[model samples]
Every structure is written in C-alpha cells, then in structure tokens.
Target: MSLGDEPGYGDAPRGEDGGYGGTGQTRTRLPDRAGDVYGGARRGRSSSRSLVTVVGVVVLLIAAIAFANRGDDESAPGTGDSDKTKTAPTAASGEQPVQSTAGGIPAGFAHTGQGAQSAAANYAVALGSAEMFNKSKRDAILTAVIIPSRVAEFESSLDKAYTPGFNKNVGLNEDGSTPQGYTFVSRTTPIGTKLTSSSADHATVEVWCSGLLGLAGDNSTNPVTNGWFTITMKLEWTSGDWKIVTHSQKDGPTPVPGDDRASSADDMAKAVEEYGGFTYAR
Candidate 1:
C-alpha cells in the first residue's frame, strides 16, 4: 500500500488518490452447482478413455527413460570439474543461524546468502506496515533498514506517495488518523524468502508476502482484505549490517484462493487488535 494512502473498499473515491499502497479489490465467486455435481456412476466410454490415458502415460514414461540413458555412456560422473560439484548451490546448509534485531526489525544476519534472505523478509514487513503512514515511525524504519546515503531520497518519495487525499479515500483523516469508531488495518506477512544473487558486499533477495489493508467499522466502505505480492530488496553490507539499498514489489506468485466466509467488520477490527505481528527470518 502507499505509505499514507488508504485503499477504497466498496466504491472508488473521487480523485486520483483513491488507491492505497497497491491494494486492490478481491472478487468472490460462488460454486456453480450443489453437491454431487459429478454423477457417481461412470459410463463404459469413460472407463475406456481412462484406460487409454493410463497407457499413453506409461508409454511416455518408458520413452523418457530411454532418452535419459542414451548418452550416459559418453559422459561419466566426476568427468567434469570436481570443484564445481563441491560448490554447487544448495537450499540450506544447516549452519548456525544469526538471529538478532535492531528497532524491532531483524538484524545481525550473517554475511551469507541465508542472511540476505532473512534481512529482505524482515524489511518487507517494515516497509508494508501501517506505521509507514506515520512520519516518525516511517523515518525510524527507514533509518534502521536503509543505507545511510539513500534514506533522504527514499523518505521524500514516500512522503509524496502518502498524500492527504489518499488518506481520506481509505477511510482515514487527512493526517492518517482512523475515523471515529473505525479501526484501520494494514499489515504484511512474509511467507518465505529466496536469495536471487549474492556477493561479498551485495545481495538481492525476494520475499513472498500476503497483506491485509483497509478499514473496519460499521458501514465502512472498505473492509480489511488480503492480497498477495512479492517484494525484492537489493542489500549492501555496510557498517557490519546488511542495509537496504533499493527495493521494489510486484503482484504475486499467488495461490488459488480457497472458499471461506468473510467476517464482519467488528470481528475484523477485534482480530487486528488482538493479533500481534511477527519478526520474520529465513
């Protein structure tokens, strides 16, 4: 979501500022038919079709095996560079993890691929938080996570993103305050992180995340809803910590949504209040 903008719930707000921090509407679909949409009994034709499908699959499997083995005799294992095999990339190494925090954000990550992944995941949460709308907290987060030189430029860009009109559109006052009797909800949950590239001083990582945004109140136009996205951060090792040099986000590697009943505004507000956020790690 925009640093200061609020997402419009039901109707689009007047002006160009209606959209908040990349938040969008989620459409719900109903099932096409009642129970037993597929009949219990299968006809003879269907059974024949299934048998043919299985036979075709078996044929393909046999052909694939033959193809894989055709050139095995020409190139034996360990014929290539032994060093390449020893240093081949792996998902995990079972190394002791670096776990620490600065200003509530995960810090003290090891200067390794895994450490870069951990830093990116935590930075995504900090950047996507509702606190970003508040100037002081936003500055604090930026200062903690961002590179020393780029902090000013990033803060200026974010200030423009969170305009007064945007705040009003998302059911908040111009100053980013929740309206009377309403609870503003904006949260980001990072599901996982991947290390795209890394070096001695620089690293790039992507964090897959789902976020909740909007307002909760009686007759509230925008209710809290979830959206999936991925955040990529370029980090540099500076001052003994991994600091964000740049960051961007895009629409997700989202999964197909499951059927679930939507909760009432009151329930949503209560849940946001009761549930605490997390500090993520890889």
Candidate 2:
C-alpha cells in the first residue's frame, strides 16, 4: 500500500518557526485520485514481504487493543464521597493555560484533565508532522514529547516506517528533502480532544484530526490531498509535564467529501508557503 493508502496514516502541519503546528491548512478541493498522490510507483518490495508486513501490523494492532483493555476491570469509574469527581472533558479549559514549551513543542501542562487533553492534541500534531520524516528533527520531537522510556522505541519505529523508499513515494528525496521546485505539504488539524480517562499520574486522551498530505508543483504527480483520522494517546505525568507513553490511530469519523473545485498545484504550493500553522490550546 502507498503511504496515503495506509488506513490510519496522516500528516501534520509545518509551523512558522519550523515547528509542528496544531491546525492543518484547509484544502479547498479534493484530488482526482488521492491514492495516486502517495502510492504511485512502487519501490520493488516482493508480494511475500508485503504480506508479512501487513500481518505484522495487524499483530501489533491486536496487541495494542489487548493492552488498552488490560486494566478495564480495575479502572471502573468511582462513586463515593472519598473519590474525587472526574472532570468532564471540554474543548477548552477555563483554568490558566500552559505557556511553556520544549523544542518548540508544547510543554508544562497542568495536572488537570484539561491539560492532558491539550497534551494529547499537541502530541497528535507532532506525531503526524512533516518533521517526523527528518531524522534529526524526528529524534528531537520524540525526546521532547514522549516519555524517556519509550523515546528510543518510538524513534526506531518511525525510522523504519519513513524509509528511503517511503520518502521517495511521498515526493521527498532519500534524505527527506523536497525536490527543487516542489513544495511538500503534510499538516494535521485537530478538531477537538476528549479525555477518555485521567488520574493524577496517568491519562488517556483522543484527538480527532484532519490532515493534508502530498506534494505540489508544476507537473507534480502527487497533488496535496486531505485525510481524516483520530489519534489516541496514553500520557503520564512525569518531570512536571505530561509526556506521551503510547499512541495509536484509527480511520476517522469523517464526513462526506464536499463538492469543491480542486486548486491548481501552484495555488496549493503558494498557500502552504504563505500560510503558517497554529499553536494549539485546549
């Protein structure tokens, strides 16, 4: 399958200061063939290997589901005077907002449920970002947003996923570079966030997001296209901040595609270059 063909795969926005942004730029039109944009020429992988890869991904997802349900019995909602009331998830927090960052990624989230939601939303943007395709920036993002224990694992997984062939498939060079004259667009916009569960030390949050991916240029095979997905992150309060422990995504609660005229490659490229992404707050 092409990168765009991957069921839950999505992209994040490039920020003004070369960081990942919270909101993805809106695409006014749909591509004629979204799959052609990301999954065009195949890099020669054998059918057998491709089948193995698919099986591996399925196994991993099954394991993730089992892990997510592991503590369900023990984590039932509490109802007693001694138990603290679980705050309902909201789109924004009325409390003072977090204002600090590490490596340009949001940091210093409060210990409240709202803070966990914010962290999840921002982390979703970071994970889906174009920066994740670059080795150095990808490492920095992993260190900044993920818990120390899982940083190495996340880095390795991403490195494997964004291989040279995959880079080429996305219209990037082997080293994750944009070819001259072409603009690479990969951005994710979070619609909202929800706190599935939270505690003083641990939290689970889900971010609903839409993204733009592909390349734009004259005669470019892959024109910018949009996608929707939901990212679920498990967070832990550590080192005075909320850090990601685990994350998984699923195909979205997407709406019907609208009837809008697709923009030209030049127009899409110009829009990406001129527009800047936002720093998300919840």
Highest TM-score against the true fold, candidate: 2
- lDDT of candidate 2 over 33-65, digit per residue (tens): 766643433334458767998999999999978
Q: Model 1: what TM-score?
A: 0.67
The list of candidate 2 runs beyond 4 A from truth reads 1-91, 94-96
Alpha-carbon RMSD, candidate 1: 15.4
List residue ranges in candidate 1 displaced over 4 A. Answer: 1-99
RMSD after CA superposition, every candidate: 15.4, 19.2
Worst 10 residues of 2 by lDDT: 1-10
Q: Give the number of the best model, judged by lDDT.
A: 2
The per-residue C-alpha lDDT of model 2 at residue 51 equals: 97
Worst 10 residues of 1 by lDDT: 1-10
lDDT of 1 by residue, 1-282 (tens): 212222232333444444433355433333345663323222233476679989999999999788657645555676654433334443334444456777787778788777788778778888888888788899999999999999999999999988899888877889988889999998999887778888999999988899999999999988788999999899999998899999999998887554356788999999999999875656
Error of 1 at 60 (Å): 25
